[model samples]
Target: MAAFTTGEAVALDLPIARVPTRATAFILDLVVQIGLALVLGLIATLMIALMGADSAWIDVAVTTVIVGTLVGYPVVCETLMRGRTVGKLVLGLRVVRTDGGPIDFRHALTRGLTGAIVDFWMLGGFGAIAVITSMCSPNARRVGDVLAGTVVIYGQKQLPAPALAVPPPWLANWVVQLDLSGIPEDLALAMRQYETRFRTLTPAAQVGLGQSLVITVCTRLGVAPPGNFPAMQIIGAVIAERQRRALTPPYSNPELLGLTPAALAAVRG
Candidate 1:
């Protein structure tokens, strides 16, 4: 179920799975929808009879349409109920980004809208073709995803840190721009591993992990790291920048290591 990068053998490194087929998986999706809609319809009918109410069948008719079902059902269910739709639950499925991140309300709405279109005209007409497109894609993105700048991935969610070896003392000194001479060995070792772990990840993954590292380091060191440079590079340059900052006439403010003064000011401010 998992693959690796040929170069690094790093995990979470492969392109994510292709989104499930719109035709096949979505066929199941529609069947679940119909069964659900009928169940709701039966309930509505019973409620109406119990109240002896018939003010507007138009509301009933409108709700019955594919559009209403797609948007209304999941919106109410997931928004109010934490990502579980009646249809999705029955199918043993949940919607999420390919990376297994939570889909925001906007994205949930997009999925519903696309599903409605797919349902209305031969189960999404052109959109259904995107399902086939997804299979060919290494990352499993469908037409809706392609258009919307998203992807669909499967399996249990993963947090985004790559396991890493300890970093060199030089690198840690560069990132913190502190002598670190007085810090105890064990504490320094722990900090070095933390920074190295983020560095080992791909650029996109690094940012997510690095932001936490940046905040923690800045709070401890009294300055932010330079934002302009890649986190790895900044860590590498930290010691040199600190040495320069220390020599300034007035003993300059402890700006972030590895960033230009202007860049450091921008990020800190």
Candidate 2:
């Protein structure tokens, strides 16, 4: 697992894809690339024969096939599929930026070029450098990942939804009243992740991270953090309020529906 703080100040804990899974994905991709190369090469050869092209043109066609298959496939796939090649999509893996965000075409191009020239083909000794680098790097990043500022992660793990957070009695009223529209989806996701992983954190980590999140949440809401409340409870209250608002009809006010703070807390519980 690797932890990254986003530009929005939200922390993400993403599961890194290790060498075994990556290698499997790579092999699958290699099979595809080879299959594509063979088919395209055959077509090119046929075209050349039909055109009565010279021997020099045959060499050019072969070089074009090799370079296109080796470099173009990954670049185009990752760019179009948002960081996933066909193999990666099948294996639930994705390449993302170091800050745990989706990668762009520039990043894909760099990774694809480095992979062909350095990680696997020209200078890699058939993946020796990639394996060694991944083994040494804590996040299992290869040469291309290091150079492109990207990492492959297990993107599609199915886990049960986290239980809704129950706001403390003292903060329930305040939480429901605050406007939550300002909180972005990414920040909300960060809050949910923090809540779900809260128990696994050490005591010191809990305090520090919880406090930091509380500050971030409060800032987004354009409010002040409560001085005396536990950060965990504050966070829970905010999340609970957000969930509550999601379920409630936009046109109907909870207050008008005769739901008091106590009732809201009970509903969340």
Candidate 3:
């Protein structure tokens, strides 16, 4: 199990995919790649025979078949499938950012390139390097994962998401005024985790962790932490406001939505 802190400061324990499972997935994918190569190769052969193609055309066809199956396959699958190649999909595994976010095309491309060039094919001794690297790494990450800032995990078994933070009525105006752009996704995740799990912690932990998070968040926003309010409330307000901004359409006015200063004052009173 590997622990990842969310933007809300919650620690999430996720099961890492070890070599055994990864190897099985790789074998499954390899079989598919080989099958695809054979089919394409046969098609190329038929085309050559029927069309009386020259040596140059044959060379082009052969190169296309090899590159398409070996490199293009995983890149396309992972990018389109959101990090699950055929083998990973079958095994309920997925590749995700180290921060537990979904990977984009850039991440998939890097991993695919690195896997073909270093981890499995050209310099890997047919996966010996990958196996050795995974064994030595705490999270079972191979060279591709390290280069791409990703990890493989049992996606089907992740913990249920925590309840979302609701913005505090009294702080709605204040939260809306603060700059939240500087806060990173991981930090935001940590704050959300802290908000949801606030009640679960002991009194001491509540004070310690909440205060620490408040300081970190305030620093990120280049603002001062509110001294009068409880730390949990501040964290919740920040998270809720962030969420509201994300969901609300651009050009929407908070005051028009009944988030007026008068309403905030009434809630505070």
Candidate 2: clashing pairs of residues: none
- lDDT of model 2 at position 88: 96
lDDT tens per residue, model 2, 129-204: 9999999999999999999999999977322122456788899889988998888756776777777778888999
**lDDT per residue, candidate 1, 1-269, as tens digits?**
43432111233543354454334455565666677777777777777778777768647644665455566765666555434565445544445544333455676677566655652344656455565666666666565565544454332343232222333454555554464334332333334444546546687767765566555555666665655555555443443344344334455533212223444454345
Q: State in Å the error of residue 53, model 1.
A: 4.7
Query: Per-model C-alpha lDDT, please?
Result: 0.49, 0.81, 0.81
Model 3, 1-269: lDDT tens per residue? 99865433546788999999999999999999999999999999999999998999999999999888888899999988878999999999998777665677888889888888899999999999999999999999999999998999998754333334687788887899998888886687777777777788999999999999999999999999876799999998987787666536783433212222343344335
Candidate 2 residue spans exceeding 4 A from truth: 157-269
Q: Given candidate 1, what's the lDDT at residue 11?
A: 38
Q: After superposition, how far is residue 44 of candidate 1 from its true place, in Å?
A: 2.3
Clashing pairs in 1: 18-140, 19-140, 98-153, 118-123, 118-124, 174-238, 174-239, 224-256
**Which RMSD does model 3 reach against the true structure?**
8.5
lDDT of 1 at 45: 75
TM-score of each: 0.45, 0.59, 0.68
Error of 3 at 168 (Å): 3.0
